[model samples]
Target: MATERPGASDGGATPQEGARTAQQIAGELRSRIDRGVYRVGQLLPTQRELGADFGVSRDSIQRAMRDLQTEGWIESRQGSGSRVIRARRIHTPKARAGQPAPISLGPLISEAFEAEEVSLDACCLTAEALTDHVGVQADRVARGEVNPRSISLRLLLPSTEPKPAFPAAADDPGDTRPYERWAAMVEFHTGRLRDRLLALQRGKFVSDVDVKVRRAPVTPTHKLYLFNGSSALHGLYVVETRAMPLSDGTEVEALDILGLQSTLFHFEKTAFERARLIHNSLVQKVK
Candidate 1:
């Protein structure tokens, strides 16, 4: 349960009315996040800002933020502020079965940008591929081929602060060199993605643009993309042993995920994706 601040109750004429107001505020915030107003990895407007916008007291805003946090829509830290970790899923047009579903990064990205408000949420081992596609879209907007009022991009990358779950040295799992190299690669790509999106706003190509990169506690086992509040693509990362060279010229055998080679499938088509394994393996493992 989320602990509320000392005076964090929001309501109306009656006690129940106050409860409803809090729910309404939380729902509205959730809808904004669902629609990309507050994309994943983006810090939500401060409580003071929200209170002023809603014409409510700071207590009311705090109540709403607490509700949102309890529902896993946002996370708040003491001083850093509240940030969205997940974008509430909304239904979009399901991909046709006949359409080519292989990872066509560019075309899909272009299609997503056709709307006035663009929201893209991606989780991956690295932002390299997403950076490339976003750069293309940003260029298109610059050339006036495609025009969008706003663009929201949220990137989720694996956090390797204390230790990483992947890219561990195969010979010695405790080694951190492989993870360090991978983290550097992630930072470089994410930096480019942020710069590209911010450039659009800076150049007056788009009226509003937000780009956020957040670190997740776990290494990604799959790559996921959600865009335009409708479409989704997903692909699993295949972990294997590979050689990773460090900056010092020494190579380490590491268990790594080959993200570039992964193939993505439409989210709607991902049902029964692994239906072939019929053995009752649980019998052997759990009993």
Candidate 2:
């Protein structure tokens, strides 16, 4: 019988196997962070929890966490668990001439505008992000860079009349000011987005620009963007306990969702059939 080596599964040592496993685990965790399954500034699950979830040994989990930390994706403390420091770049399908890489929302929207006709449907806590990116695209159009003849945008925001949910004061249940602030924010940003899109038509940059806004009764748990029926980008709203300062200098602990910091995951229609169906259904429902 052959004697077993120190790092071997059988007789031969396989140090590379452990390294490869660590790499694979690191990649998966990185993907999750990029896709918002793990969010920035959020503490990651404990090593034991992660080890169980990944069906790996504690050493493997430690190696993967070390890899993430070395790559600047996370930070670990002695007593505290690992926390997400930053998200990795979203890999786009390809690159285009004279256009930047599609790593974030702005570039993705600009890429969408390269089409002859553009359709953007988004449902989120606020239209602030969409509005910001549209502004960037508007500048591109203004420069005669992208000339989409028709642009159709539909926005679905939570109804403010009836307080939906979340953003409530954690300690003081009677205080509803945080909810009110969120509602006002949604309304303001939605209005701004509408005005910006309408301006595109007014400027004669685009022959047809249709902007529609609707109120959803349900509080949004996730933000969804379906781009021209081809691809979908989704991000979950993570409710966190944080303190919010009111206009009158009153600070209260409340449950809140960080919008812009949420990592967005991209999916193509061909790859995720169920996601495609859900996206289509949502579009129709909001229409």
**What's the lDDT for residue 208 in model 1?**
99
In model 2, the Cα lDDT at residue 194 comes to: 80
Candidate 2 on 205-235: residue-level lDDT in tens? Answer: 9999999999968889988888887877887
What RMSD does each model have against the real structure? 21.8, 14.2
Model 1 CA lDDT for position 160:
73
Q: Cα lDDT of model 1 overall?
A: 0.75
Off by over 4 Å in 2: 1-103, 271-287
Highest TM-score: which candidate? 2
Q: Global lDDT of each model? A: 0.75, 0.76
Clashing pairs in 2: none
Per-model TM-score, in order, reads 0.57, 0.59
Per-prediction tally of clashes: 3, 0
- lDDT score of residue 167 within candidate 1: 79
Give residue 48's error in model 2 in angstroms. 50
Candidate with maximal lDDT: 2
